[model samples]
Target chain A: MSLRIPSVLVSLVALGALAATPLAAEPKSRFKVGWSIYVGWMPWGYAADTGIVDRWAEKYGIAIEVTQFNDYIESINQYTAGAYDAVTLTNMDGLSIPAAGGVDTTAVIVGDFSAGNDAVILKDSTSLAEIAGRNVNLVEFSVSHYLLARALDSVGLSERDVRVINTADPDMAAAFQTRDVTAMVTWNPIVSEIAAMPGANLVFDSSDIPGEIIDLMVANTAVLADNPDFGKALAGIWYETAALMVADTPEGAAARAAMGAASGTDQAGYEAQLAATRLFADPAEAVAFTLSPDLGTTMDHIRTFLFDKGLLGAGAPSADVIGIELPGGAVMGDPANVKFRFDATYMQLAADGAL
Target chain B: MRLINRHPGRAARLFLGSLPFLILVVAYLVASAARLADNPGDKLLPALSSFAQAIETMALTPDRRTGAYLLWSDTWASLTRLWAGLGIATAITLVMGLAIGVLPVMRALLAPVVAFASMVPPLALLPILFIALGLGETSKIALIVIGVTPFLIRDLSLAAAALPREMIVKAETLSASTWLIALRVVLPQVMPRLLDSLRLQLGPAFLFLIAAEAISADSGLGYRIFLVRRYLSMDIIFPYVAWITLLAVAMDLGLGGLRRLMFPWWGLEGRR
Candidate 1:
């Protein structure tokens, strides 16, 4: 004789199983942030190493873990996948990948923009128009690609006018040395290395589109909403360390030295990269920049470029698919589907001495 | 091991054979649970649900940007390059290996050169290939062929050289031409070993394919892995790696099965 298990018993067991697993709750005390090696983000490493991060976290009654990823993309990926609470990313990448992938992210601190750091260099040609009909080697679908598109737009040309050869960033310098590769778009120190070569001309750079290519410390909007103090602590650490690094005092020099060592570059090399990067050294400046209308226009340009390149996801109907909320309730793209948000509240708190 | 091999029933034997795989699964689950207990947000050793979700997104959902299922597209791209590279390498190996092994002049001229070429790391020639061949499908395919062909040629040549002397002498005594002797005697003996050599080269072939695709390619399994890798989407990465392993294993099994079916007399002794 077989004992029969009733359907009611099965339902009860299923419900019990479902109830056994607890739902994810807010992380109250501990948080982790991931950063990559870049001149602008070096302050994070310095802050963590110098105990500034610990001090700020202690004030907030929390523990913050700062992890450095060797690969720039991996850090952003880790943050997007929820391994880290916050990550350093570019405006275009933040929009294209995470926001487009349906992760609600907020750019809390506008760390810096590529002023002259990203550039288009031509072999033996001093003009942007000379790039027409030439094979340009660059890391395709990267900021260098965006820079190329913008440079081409300035000359009243499009991607159709030139051939793009997708060369890796590491191989860009060497690829440009080849007689066949006439032009290249890359970032420092590759850009600097190539520009210094004989017959290499810097025809265009990110300075041409100031504030368009932004580097940011973005946090998951849900995480930021749940732990507002995390943002405050991060902002505090950023501004304090940034101000110290920018100053001419020995303390500032030491900070820069530490940052340089952390990023595998010398003091002069770090300084060179810094010279090309426009850091928002002051909290008020960062706050104001986030609040400005130019931020909207820059994001609009980025979204359009991303959509056109098919980097904004496969079925993105238009550039407006990923809504970006700026400071003061202004929104760009799809207002209903707002994923990327610029919350200057934390930066404002820092500026107003609230942190 | 002896106990499992001596098992009388097929079911019992199969169950015992799968014990190691079961052990691995249980071990992974234990480690994953421990990690999740400490930090729920850990990306390393992600939960099984996350892996399932990632697989669904990559394999089922059409990419919102390209309107293509990433997994299928990447598989097609990678498989196309792999087969093309392997096909070309096989043809070259068959001709070059046989000629070198058979003729004294060919062996003297080609053996040392092929041996030396195999010693140079294939990755070092990537830049030269890209520069000379351009960053097209040609360069990627060329890289795979270049990477695996030398090793395959050397193996095949050695296999061909090891052929019994009496067979060749008998064929010559029968007034068989050089071409007839090679086609009838050497070719039949070497073909099965060639399949074995091809199987051996699949791992290196995949390595070359991924390296080439990683450096430059619009789409491929390697390209997709590296692309989503920027986001540390382990869910997609783990499945992709698993899929690649599955594909490689399937290929190995298929080749082995074909060898058994086609060359019934060719046993373990026949394989070098």
Candidate 2:
């Protein structure tokens, strides 16, 4: 109901913008990066609050605007619509949403992957096999759903065996309290909250199928190509904040506490979440992971999954419709129509202490 | 001449009524075409061809996994929940509204509670509904009932209470008891008003139903919109919204027909 006011205001602003466009047209030096609440991506918010983002931007003679979103998917959608120059999302989402939607996106940083943070929790179910016939509840088409698909595949069962109930994240916890909802697949801190329920069994998690659900900071390829300094500024801001988040110093402790508070938790709660995530706190490790051969295999799996779910753009006959240019000039999908790329230059620069 | 006296002919009135809609459609098309020309993949405003393809895909083609044409199944699911919720609310309101208005004791007890409950935002209890009633159709229906029942009761009760006191006195003089006066005098006046209250409450009921479904549901028009929204599929979302509007308009028309058939004398400007 409140949206109507903003919609009317937006139209007025749009009309005003039309009149002001001529005077405002200039070379773009400022970039906006959209991020949502996540353990791996929390550093973006912390850095922005502490002026690390602006400091790096000043160093590179550019201005970077880091904004936080309450919704994960909304940030990605806005980024895909050209409202933001960059966004933080999982590799699967990057491929399925922006890449499939014809936005040329490139990963500037590989943050972390879920180890045990995401899970499939079943009430009174002891093993993954018990989940065969039950309807799996999750945020449909999200990483949780992808995890469920992978979980079912491990046991030789396909999506045909069980129905997928598309439940929202806010309702998943309460829905699980009802006896009718016996099984759910979700991510932490939701996963951690659900696991504490009586008779709840954590049958499978991202830890079991590691490195597939990668967290990344992806930017528009055309925008990055025009302004290399924007990429450098982002890499600089990230490494500095990443170092502080995991350090044993008091300042690091304070950084973690602020991030936890910003993410709707406390210090200990944030630490518990960090324990389940495989955070690449080191720049070199992040670069190594981005260039690894396993990334190719993971991308192959992701593209195939997206194609099967019909998320790889409309009328896409195969997974090859959206090309993904990997590191070292190797391309997956159609080489002629590359839209998603895994670029490692900025991260490599960060690793070599050259950023 | 006064502005109220300057009325158009029926043909002119129809054209005037339709002018705004035509202008909106033309504006949307022009904006969409311009966006598409700049970047064909703009999902914010989908092209006309994209809309046609989306409509065909959702309304005509059967889903791959479920083998159900999404449009019909969603409509069936949503309509069933709406009917069940509104029907149960209307029945409860008729009985309670009459009791509260005709009987002093019932009014003293329920009027305060009804006012309080009506003020409580219905969406706030959505999670509790899921927790208490489970995630099935029951919780979704319960949300709608909890959302609109109080208002329906209030409307009917006021209509019942407004009956001239002399009628009740005369009925009592003829040996009509409390129950007799409620049945003979109050129910007759309030029954038609119940229909009006139900008609007014349809829009709000649909809002509650869609919110519940969007949060959690296996199938519904709201569920489909939120589900495909993960991929930013505006192509599908726009059409599903239009279909829901059309369905709501048809329902309004149906209720208006029922009102005319059942009680042709009852109307907004007092009974004929």
Candidate 3:
């Protein structure tokens, strides 16, 4: 009996040692980022394709996994379902999906805002005002819809002034060919493709409404709270890439091609596309863009526009609902300044050109 | 009266009875015409027609994706997946139903749980299932079993309850074993009703099965419909839906025929 007891104790000790060994070992972050084939996410893809992802991830000592999704909604769905740690999303989609799905997330980095990459292509209509009482097709509640509403407001026309057709992005180009839709508000390469087609005129583009289209590299709130250092490192990598991209020299052209190849676009097309997107190379400028005094007003516009269009749920766009600041000076929030954390320490350091 | 009856033709009555159907067709055509008039370039009708044409085109082609050759196309792959899922679900339900049906105490304890599970909408658990089992065949099959087994158990329990207590008593009195009595007395009676219930469950089972296939699956009739929807090829989608409906009807007929063959002279009214 005495011998058996000692042997049992030894066995238990051995099992404990085995379990403790793994626990003490280094754990990989399994950093998962979700992306759709949008233009803004070209950097992440470029980083991966050019092996910059490895260097950044290694600098932070984590294993990063990138997943490409065909549709924006699917990426949001996966993010909501906890399949992704980070995602590329627009300001409104960030609010709609992660926030609405009850998962607190943080918008960490400001990607390029749309300049002329998005447009409302009209057939036989020269001006926005001429589109009144005509069918204007677009995916409902998408950025295009927001752009269209803003475009219409500029011309003093309401949504009721035109017939809104529920054509999704993949079908919008084809829908235009059918001649059923007189006008369509969409993003490129759909916009570029449609404009290339004979007789399709650009009624309005994102250039008309500056700073309204904000894209971001957003992280789940819990992940950001636990790893501010990692966030800083990732931000360092992004700003460095942006610096290379905006140079517009021989090196800049190479960087452009790297980004272009990731998105399956040609070098010339990529440069043209980049020209239409105003990127903030300076971290201070990016931070200002997020926390500008006009941000509150911009969010209010988004809220009122979405609410009137029956898109936003019944509630005011409360700041607290949009973002919460962490213990560290890291800012996490909704894109339009309603929900934001202003942790510029990492971005500030990166602006000094340090990784 | 005799002269009028002599002049009465079966053809005249048939023609008179068909008038309502003809009127319905005309009304449908008129409504469609009005819709066309409302929007000349509305492409919904032409899109639907093109989709139908696409399906007919694809069906006749011996191409790999979806052609007349079932072995060469997605038809075989999808059919195999569906049947494998169905077969596993049927096996699980049968075993569970038999276990509960054969035991009165188990029936009392588990019938309500099974009933509650069946009452829950299977589609509502889709996201949960996706998270748990992923977009794989396992989740899809698991859903089918969850949706199907309770009704089978309920019916089997009732069938078991209907079996007389006297038979077991008599068997015990004669020194015959419990197993012997159950096998001799209960088994024969339950088999007929079990087959009947199986036939009845075919409709709901197929409905839930198709719905499960529709959500997040990469390949199936549901996937095919959605893929064509992306391209606005409704012509193919329509014919595919029609073909699937016909396939389901054929299944129903086969099951009905099998039921008749097995339960000959049972005089089972309202079997469907």
Candidate 4:
């Protein structure tokens, strides 16, 4: 009956003297990617600014659109609800939302791990040990929270020894300035602003614990399965963009400035922010970062930290939740084969000057 | 003399004032041991000290030097957005209330819908409004209309219903038209009630305005709070909140004065 209706409509339309049309090219495969206004995810804004996103999308016969979010949590929330094809998220939120919600999602590319970006800012003369019993402001259960927890472990203190105030990110700098907070866990430019305040000092940062503040491009498990080629194309484009960023060129500077502007910072400010984030200049390095043997031990610490903080729900999540696997061949999760393959196969082709 | 006349409420005032002192004393005693053992001051004290320092640095710094738009921009931007939204809402309420209130059948049909709408929290509609209207002034105006029109409808209905039966009867006996009776009798009766209703909704409209402006807005007082929150700028947040509160209070006073001036016969309940 449905088939008959379309045929009848086609015949009726044909009678109306409109062109008995030749079939049209398929509509562009428009995909929306969401990212928060963070320095780590500057590449997303840069790709959009440099026209690399659209160029790559056109090459793959797809149209790519990017949406920048003000709040990291809301971006993850929107991503979890399948509002976007992919989203840039911290390793923790990536786990809490898409991973925990039973959505088979894969972290395709590792962007940059925080080095000195996430910091424990304090006022007056104080060591990390001296921060005991002080109220530390941070968005609870976020990567900065983990950074704070890790900072405490280095000083032989527990996060429990200090009061944790559930302050949002945008307010952290002001909190530090107000001196109402003894300490706060946050990222730049707020970090830079607070560090500039007289009597303010950075007690610790992600640089103190490398490879902890991981950023990734996460794809929905189902969409990835249906369009593996699009995944490969995205991986190619992301690495290409990263390569351009690290190289010395006018385009790179312009792209960096655009990212800085989007983040409400200047070129120098943006470069300063980038200096603190350990960006993978090459996709092979990113791939290596993903598969390190320490990934297990560190993620165990992360998972345990999350479970203790009540960010992870119910049971303890297994280490396999990270889902690290080689690209092309191996499939981990069922049906969609959720792959965290930061494999440089496509990126290597994009680099060495090949697409 | 007024103080003596209001002396019966003195016990409540004293209790309220003493409550903070009692809390402080208990808190201090508990923190004294920590202060002695750790040689650290109380958290609130440090928080306040830092806040004062931040205020002196940021708020005191000239706008040109600090690149701040100044506190005045917040007041002006927020007030302009709210006035525009309120203007649209008032238009909607006036039209809908007039149409629905005069006809008893229309009033009966809409009473349940308006009552149900009135029960809905305005903030809850923000996301749906955003989706439908795309996070612009339109959404804010739509929400304000949805938030306020129901009260106006209800008030106008009651005012129309309370019209003296003798006036209607005499109008009918004199072979007066419905339109003539409505303009001459029903409107004058409803005018005072409408003013009261508008005044009552002013506070709620302001509340929803601030909340809506807080979410996804780039400018306005609420946005100022959110923007400053990223830096934990509680000093700025608190001042902006206080400013909005003052604006709301002033609007209430102004509306009350206007109500008294416009409707001389209405007592404090309506005049306010």
- The candidate that achieves the highest lDDT relative to the unseen native structure: 2
Instruction: Provide TM-scores for the models.
Output: 0.78, 0.95, 0.52, 0.53
- Using DockQ as the yardstick, the better of models 2 and 4 is 2
Of candidates 4 and 2, the better by TM-score: 2
Which lDDT tens digits does candidate 4 get at residues B1-272? 67657654688989988999899656544433332232121111123444465455435654532356456666776788777767776676665666576677777787788888878877677666665674556765677777877777777776777778898999989998878888777777677777667778887777676666655454567655654433223335545555677888888778778777887777656524
Q: What does chain B score (TM) in every candidate?
A: 0.91, 0.95, 0.75, 0.74
DockQ of each: 0.17, 0.50, 0.02, 0.02
Model 1: DockQ against the native?
0.17
Q: What are the lDDT scores of the predictions, listed in order?
A: 0.82, 0.86, 0.64, 0.66
Q: Which segments of candidate 2 are over 4 A away from where they belong?
A: A1-27, B1-4, B173-175, B268-272
lDDT of 1 by residue, A1-355 (tens): 0011123234323333322332233767888899988888999989999999999999999999999888687576556545578999899989876786566899999999999999999999898999999888777778999999999999999888888766667677766766677888999878887888899999999999999999999998888888899999999999989999999999998888888888777788889999999999988888888888888888888999988876665446889887899888788878888889999999899899899
TM-score: model 3 vs. ground truth: 0.52
lDDT of 2 by residue, A9-95 (tens): 364335323322211113478888999999999999999999999899999888888989988987998787677889999999998
Per-residue lDDT for A4 in model 4?
24
TM-score of model 3, chain A? Answer: 0.82
